[model samples]
Target chain A: MNKTVLQIIRFVVLVLFQVLVINHIRLGGYVHPYIYMLFIMLLPFNTPKWQLLVLGFALGLTVDLFTGTPGLHAGATTLMAFCRPSIIQLISGNQKFENIPEPNLGQLDGMWFFRYVLCLVFVHHFALFFLESFSFRLIGQVLLRILLSVPVSVFLIMMILYIFKRERKRE
Target chain B: MYNLQRFILKHHFVILFILLEVISILLLARSQNFHRNSLVNTSNVVVGKIYEWSSDVGNYFRLNTANEQLAEENAMLRQQLSIVYDTASCVYDVNEGDTLYEYIPAKVVNNSTNQANNYIIINKGARDGIERDMSVISTDGIVGVVTDVSRHYASIMSLLHSKSVVGVRFKNNQEIASVKWQTNNYRYGIVEDIPTHIVLQQGDTILTSSHSKIFPEDLMVGTVEEFYPTAVDALNKAKIRYATDFSTLRHVYVIKDLHKAETDSLKAKFQ
Candidate 1:
């Protein structure tokens, strides 16, 4: 499949899954995992920075439309996309991505991919929760939500990636 | 001039990032104000249609609970029918032939309680006689007030939202107070401005007071769970478990007050 077509398919599937399935999963109201960030995380390594930010904004806006929060997600996801290149550099250290097309379990070692996902997910969730609250008055609750939701979101994203990884391996 | 142009060209991505962030923040700020009809929201026709479709699937699984709730409300309304009441002749000043409020039934197309500023979208909108600032209530208790409406859907500012406040009073004594959700907990809210003189019980019922223009007086709000006097104001604040389980809310009524315009105009005179 063409790369753009594949990404588009992934985008639609992930957004629908996030809205219809993940948004309905409320574990004590604290574990609202935003696995939609996976779309931005899985973009190809050589994708342009401007495209990343725009796509991030679009994805978040789509979610906001469904959730009735106009720009909370958009703001957070845009910030995450802006920080993506720096986070990747900070995590990968001297490792080059000349051959690696995307950051996935298939291309990267488990530990490195885990660390990459953890850092980016943290950035996304932290921004998202804080922006959603938009006040320090409920800082404690917001912080708790971030702490509880990040691991769950990461786990869900990793499970999804693992499924993809197994399919590719079988092929 | 050339150097400036070069700087702009090199840092275009950074500039774009800043611009997008500013737009996002502006939108966030605008949405925080409940009165504004934001350009992007669940009440948008396309978005509401998508949620309506999804809720159609989701509602099938919740039909048992939804039916039970409707049955309960039906039983209660049955007891209030004129046929069930006894007629007595007395010198009573009765005002006849006036309908004070009208209710438009709506289905909860989408609702969220996990967010700090939660909102609910109902299937009824302008086309169905729904309007902004109308009170929304479930069979069990008060739900929210309509904040935005499109042609086919209306968005409600849920009582669980941080900015949502309701004027409520003790059902026993009519002592007025206001309920506000200070935390993310949807099951409970904080009651403010209770008179320190009134003795409160553990399970006192709180009902909406007449002070509110949107909500009709004496509507069930919640029950008092715990209370304490504030050190600064010497006024009592209490925690009340909300009567409406926002998490399970599916059906609601959008109430239209027939005399709201007159009441609003009268109240606006004092201001």
Candidate 2:
């Protein structure tokens, strides 16, 4: 499959999995896994900066529409997309992450990929949670939600990254 | 001019990003673009379909829990129905001339207690003799006021939700206040802006005042859970434990007075 078709398929499967499956897996309280971020993280490195932003916004807005949080998810995901290039460079300046098939644990390995994803995921989720809670004051409750959500989101991200790692090993 | 055009074309990706960001920022800042309602956007259709499918899937999983709850409620309702004729409506015990208090039943088809600006949807609508501004209550206490009515469904401003401001009095005392939720904590909220002259205690019971045309004279809200008298301002704040367990609430009554529309119209004219 070509890049666009593969990307589209990946997006559909991941988002469907998130809304249909992952969102339902709410662990007790506020710790809901956000496997949806895979859409943004999976965008090919060589994708144009503007295209990346738009795609990110589209993916986020989609999530927001489903979740009933208008503009919040879009805003958070767009921020991640905007900073994707910087994150790649920060992770490895010489390696040129663009030529790679997609983001994977094996490709950006030895905790480089983990930390890279960790930072971006936190940024995305922090923006989302904060924006939704904007009208209300940030009590300990708000902090608690963020702390709870991070681990779930990280686990999902790692799982998706592992899939990419598997695909890369085949090549 | 050619060199400038080439430069612009070379940096077009950056320009596009800037433009897109500006659009998103604009939507965020101005809430009502009317035509730009996110619910009607391209993303919405896809997301809506996915969410509907997800809700269907999720509801299946939650059905077991929901079944247990329904069974418990059925027993409670059956018990209440059995004793409907025998029990006294008023707790304080009325004197000589007291009219029979009537309750208008309503079923909540739609409920949103988790959201900030939440509303409850009742199956009763215009056809069911429902109208806007009617007070909704459960046997436990006040639920909300009917805000909108259609042919089949009426929407209510849920008491647990934010933006619910009902006029209330404290323990048959001098001060009248508005009861509103601080957040999603439906069990508790503050009776804000109560006057200083009203002496308060920890155990003092707060009730819905009759001043608001919605509810009648005195209905139980909850006991004063906590209080902080104003250090600077005259009005004090006190947290109230709401009577109804909102999470477990099932049935409710829509309080409709015959004179509600007239009174509502008169109030609107003055405003």
Candidate 3:
């Protein structure tokens, strides 16, 4: 499939899944995993800086509209996108991206991919929860929420990516 | 001029990032103000319609629970009706003459309890006589207040939200306090401003106080789960278990105070 068309389909599917399914899963009221961050994470390596930021903002705004939070998700996701390129460079030190088309489990070493996902997911979740609380007064609760939610979100995103990669290999 | 253009072209990414962040911050600021009509809430027709469709499917899975709640409310209403009929005819006539509150039934199209700032979208909206600032309550207890309304839908600030507060009083002694959700727990809220003289007890019922302009007096709020004296303030604080199970909330009533305008105008004179 064409890469652009594939990414578009992934965008719609992930957004629908996040809003309709994941948003309803409130385990202990603390583990609200935002799996839609996968859409931003999985974008092509060569995607333009401008496109990355715009797409990130649009994706988050779509969720905010559905969830009735006007700008909380938008701000966090945009910040994640802004930091993506730098985080990628910082994680893949001394490694060249000449042969790699994008960051994925198949193309990157398992440890490297895990570290990358963890870093970006942490940034997203940290920004999201802190922005949602928007207060230093509730810093303890906010930190606890970030600590609990990030791992769940990272795990779910990686699981979905692994399943899709396997299906593509079989095809 | 060429040097300036080159600088702009070289650092466009940073400029764009800052621009988008600024827009997001503006939106965040706008939404934080309680009275402002935000541009990107679920009360918008498109978003509300989507949630309405999804909740339609979700409703089937919880039908049994919803039915039980309705049945329980019916029994309670019937009990109230019998008492009303048993009263003196003169007193009944006087009660009929003054109807201070009106209720508009609405279905929950979308709801969330886990977010720090949670909101509920309902099916009824401006067309159904739902307006901003009207109080919402479930069959069991108070829910929230309407904050935004479109033609076909309205968005409510749920009691689970960090900023949501309700004026409440103890049912046993009528001593007033305010309930606020300071923690992530949906079933519990923190009660503040309790008078130092009032004795505390677990399982005490809390009801909406007459001091509130939005909610009616004596509506069920919750029950005392625990109490403690805060180190900083002389007032005692307590934890209360909300009467309404927000996780399964489906149907609700939007209360319209008939004399709200009169009350506001009268209160404005003092200000």
Give lDDT: candidate 2, residue A96.
65
* True contact recovery of candidate 1: 0.70
A19-91 in candidate 1: lDDT tens per residue? 8788877788677898898899989999999999999999988888888787888988998999999999998
Query: Model 1: per-residue lDDT, tens digit, B32-110?
Result: 8878546863348988898899999989998998888889889879877544343422433234546789889999988
DockQ values of all predictions = 0.72, 0.36, 0.76
Q: Each model's TM-score? A: 0.94, 0.69, 0.95
lDDT of each: 0.86, 0.68, 0.87
lDDT of 2 by residue, A1-171 (tens): 577787788888887777556654535444645778777776767777888888988887766555444576788888888888888888776776555666666665648767777778887877666665654575566667678888878877887677667765765
lDDT of 3: 0.87
Q: Which run of 10 residues does model 1 chain A get worst, by summed lDDT? A: A162-171
**The TM-score obtained by chain A of candidate 1 when compared with the true chain A:** 0.96
The best candidate by DockQ is 3
- Looking at candidate 1 chain B, the ten consecutive residues that score lowest on lDDT are B86-95
- Model 2 lDDT tens row, B1-271: 9999998899876776676656655555453221224343344334434444544554577777666865786798889765753575454343544434545776554454444445565666788888777788876777888766666556676786545677888875747888888764657878878888776888887788878666766877777888888879888888888886666455678876755556679989989
- Clashes in model 3: which pairs? none
Compute the TM-score of each model's chain A versus the native chain A and list the values. 0.96, 0.88, 0.95
**Is model 3 an incorrect, acceptable, medium or high docking prediction?**
medium
What ranking emerges by DockQ with the best candidate at the front?
3, 1, 2
Full ranking by lDDT:
3, 1, 2
